[model samples]
Target chain A: MSLAHKGLPFDRNRVSFKEIPKLENGYSAKVPIIRDEDKLIADSFAIALYLEDRYPDRPSLFKGEGGRAMARFVEGWSQMIIHPFINVVILMPVHDLLDTPNQAYFRESREKIFGRTLEDVAATRDAKREAFTASLEPIRKTLLSQPFIGGESPLFADYIVFGAFQWVRVLTSYKLFDAGDPVQDWFERCLDLHGGVAREIKAAA
Target chain B: MSLAHKGLPFDRNRVSFKEIPKLENGYSAKVPIIRDEDKLIADSFAIALYLEDRYPDRPSLFKGEGGRAMARFVEGWSQMIIHPFINVVILMPVHDLLDTPNQAYFRESREKIFGRTLEDVAATRDAKREAFTASLEPIRKTLLSQPFIGGESPLFADYIVFGAFQWVRVLTSYKLFDAGDPVQDWFERCLDLHGGVAREIKAAA
Candidate 1:
């Protein structure tokens, strides 16, 4: 998304979690390692920052320094509230999509981290149903007055929040928002960004 | 804060909830109304925006429009999570500070709004203790890298979050942050802003 928003096209590298350690001969223990010539940057956020700084003339991600900082808070809010909910909701589905060895690896790693089976974790989604919806109050409230979290047009803050919905959209058919939800409107608008780029990828049933 | 942060000095008008209806001959029915010559602005946030736009030459409250929009999300998070907790924690203390007539008014109004007595509401502080601490995770994560929410220097986003803590500071002795908590460090830095303006008002004991 940082790359897409920046108008800098790049080839995709589909490395599994098991392959993250071997990238660039143990350069970083992360999935989002981007190789630009001799330089390799890891972490989604660091890559966005790097792209923003390294390519100043391209379309900006943050728009300004203030957006750069506040985008982190949005990230914190999303990761703390939205991601945990969405991750659980799609856990079983995600596990189903992986190959046999990777599926076992996924289950093992996730179970160890969560201390719960995939079925048990996904079951917890119903309990967190109300909270997951309520957690989006800030985003709903913001979209009431502005077209995007960054205001008027998309910025890093909008991208930061849209990433969550985009993730949920591709992995599961679960309806996270109500029919008239402001977030639903915002999500559609996001999908249409950069000439209907995100919408091209059909959602997994 | 919008006034003080903008290097603008203004007189304070202490109006009780009962007296809010009488302000400007019933022009507005809320607190934090700023009168500039013939114009009257209501709502703390609206007043801040008005000040930011009106006083362009003075120090900016938001620093930029990005901060302006993102500040609302910070406001949303604070009001959603922290405000509920702190309001309950300081319910009795705030009621105690009011005169007999105002105390009855405060208790009646608040209890009606909450559907519970001040005592019942304050008691909820204990149950929400863990969640309240956990809610500060985003702020904790942000401060680990930056000194303030807006990064490098304070912006309206910093003020938006700080208002909740500052409210608790002056109204009650309840410690919201543990010693060495990053939020505490940030709160102290906020208190020291504009020549320690917030600290001049001693805490309620």
Candidate 2:
């Protein structure tokens, strides 16, 4: 999204859970390792900083000064609260998409993080739905005035939060937010950005 | 703090709970009302926006793009979590400072907000302290990489969070943060800002 937001054309390299650790000749054990010319940057927030510094001429990811720092706070909030909830939600849908070895790897790893078996976690998703929506107080309150977290237009902070929302949207058809929710409205607006790239990236069949 | 952050000079107008509604001939019934020439801004966040817009030649309250929006997010997060916690914390200490009529107004209004008697709320202070600290996860995680929430220097976002902390600091000597906690370090850094004006303001006897 940051690259696309910057108008930088790139190729998508899809790798399953098992393939992530084997990338870049043992350079990283993580996915999202971006190779820009000779520069290989990994991790989303690190990549945001790298892009901001390297592509000063490009459209900014963190527009304005307090942007990067506040973006970090947004990332922290989304990662700690929102992303964990989505992780529990996407478990089964993701497992269904994985090949056997990857599925095994996925369940074992994800169960450790969630501290619950996939079936057990899925059992409570219905009850947890409202809790997830209620937890969006900060973001919901933020959009009460501004059109985006980055103010008039989307910024890196918007992408950080949208990544969490988009993660759930691409998986199950389940409703994470109620109809007419400001966050849901923001998500739709986000999907409409970058020439509808977010919508163009089709959800799993 | 926003005024101080922008290097603007101001006089403090301390109003009692009962006296607040009388400010500016009932123009606003709120504390933190700023009378900047002809502009009478009521809310804290609104005052911040007013200051930023009115004093463009001054040091920027929000240094870069996405700043105002991200600051709103920071304000939302702090108000929802931190400020409410401090409001509960300072209930008794604030009550202690008021005279008879003001004390009656304070207790009645605050009790309505908390939905509990002051004594009942005071009884749970020790238990709630750790919970308040636990809620600082986003701010703590942000401080892990950057020195301040707005990056190298403190911005309105830092002051938004610090306002809550400072409220507690002024009314009581009770330690809100544990020693050597990253938040404590950040609070001290905030205290040291603008020639230690936060410290010079003095704490309750």
Candidate 3:
């Protein structure tokens, strides 16, 4: 959505390890890669920041000091809260719901890394979810009072948070967000600005 | 040391909360406030960014795109890894060692919020520390290959990571970090830049 908003030529391709030849470096890579001219970049945040920096003439994804602080706060808070919470509850279960081979691999990976049973993982996940949701109250209160996180204009903070919240909404069927009237209006404004990419993604999913 | 390096005034007195009256708004009314007359800012990151923004004549703390990405990555990683790890292993124990009424209040607040016993928190913390340290292999590799995190120049990323690592060094006797020769040399360079302030803080402790 943000990529499209930045007016960049974004090519979305789904590739697997089998599709690519082995590198001389001995790493079998089958990840999403973004190419702008000769520059090939990896990592979501890295790509986003790179685009923002390269196209400063276009409308910015970040603003001034307050905007930067708010964006950082939201991004940092999401990593602290939403990422871990969603990983435990939604992603783990979704991985299990996949085919037998993938599920077996997932289980083995979880056991090897976390050293916990499926049931134990689920219980711990639930606890984290509860704590994360409770922690969102402060953020909710702050958002309720503002049109956008950084005041009147919607920025990258909204997109980053909205992305996380969308995943939670899809997985849990929970509407744990209420950014109040101004924020609600600002969200619609963002969708309009991004040429309804948010709606398109949500509808597709 | 960051405060000192910026040539800001520091409050000399450390007064008890009992000496001040509480605000009707339920927030701190008479708490000690660190002030910079030139720029009115509160948060450390805000202050750092503000200094970078305002003092264009001085070399920027955050450089360009790669520098910004490096800073954000380090900032996010430190919050995700270092803070929680040190809080559980070193901070909680040290708080207990202090055995102050304020420390007890802090423990109670954490318990009520996170719903974990101190020992449980500590163990969970240790596990996170191990995982974080293991994950740092790639980051260490990157740092070892460069003079600073953003290449030859020390950016905001260096300072942000340094602050967290400094805390760990202070609170615990554990020697967990080794980013090879270049990183160690960079660390010494940052300490040298900060001058006697770092030494003074350590001496005070």
- Per-residue C-alpha lDDT of model 2 across residues B97-205, encoded as one tens digit per residue: 8999998988898789889999898878888888788878898889987899999888889988898889888999888998879999999999999989899979766
In TM-score terms, candidate 3 sits at 0.53
For residue B88, model 1's alpha carbon misses the true position, in angstroms, by 1.1
| Number of backbone collisions per candidate | 0, 4, 0
Stretches of candidate 1 above 4 Å error? none
Q: What is candidate 3's DockQ?
A: 0.07
lDDT of 1 by residue, A45-124 (tens): 88888999999999877767778888888887778888888889889888888888889999999999899898999999
Chain B of candidate 2 vs. true chain B, TM: 0.95
Q: TM-score of each candidate?
A: 0.95, 0.94, 0.53
Top candidate on lDDT is: 2
Ranking under lDDT, best-scoring first? 2, 1, 3
Candidate 3 lDDT: 0.55
- Model 2 CA lDDT for position B179: 81
lDDT (tens digit, per residue) of candidate 3 on B138-184:
34554544555545555566677677656655666665555554444
- Number of the candidate with higher DockQ, 2 or 3: 2
Greater DockQ among 1 and 2 belongs to 2
Write candidate 3's Cα lDDT for A1-205 as tens digits.
5587587667676443344333323333533356788777664555657777889777666653233333443565566556766666655545645677666766776677768865677678644655565555434444444445533555676676667655554556443434453434554665665666665545212
List model 1's recovered fraction of native interface contacts, to 2 decimals: 0.50
lDDT of 2 at A34: 91
Top-DockQ candidate index: 2
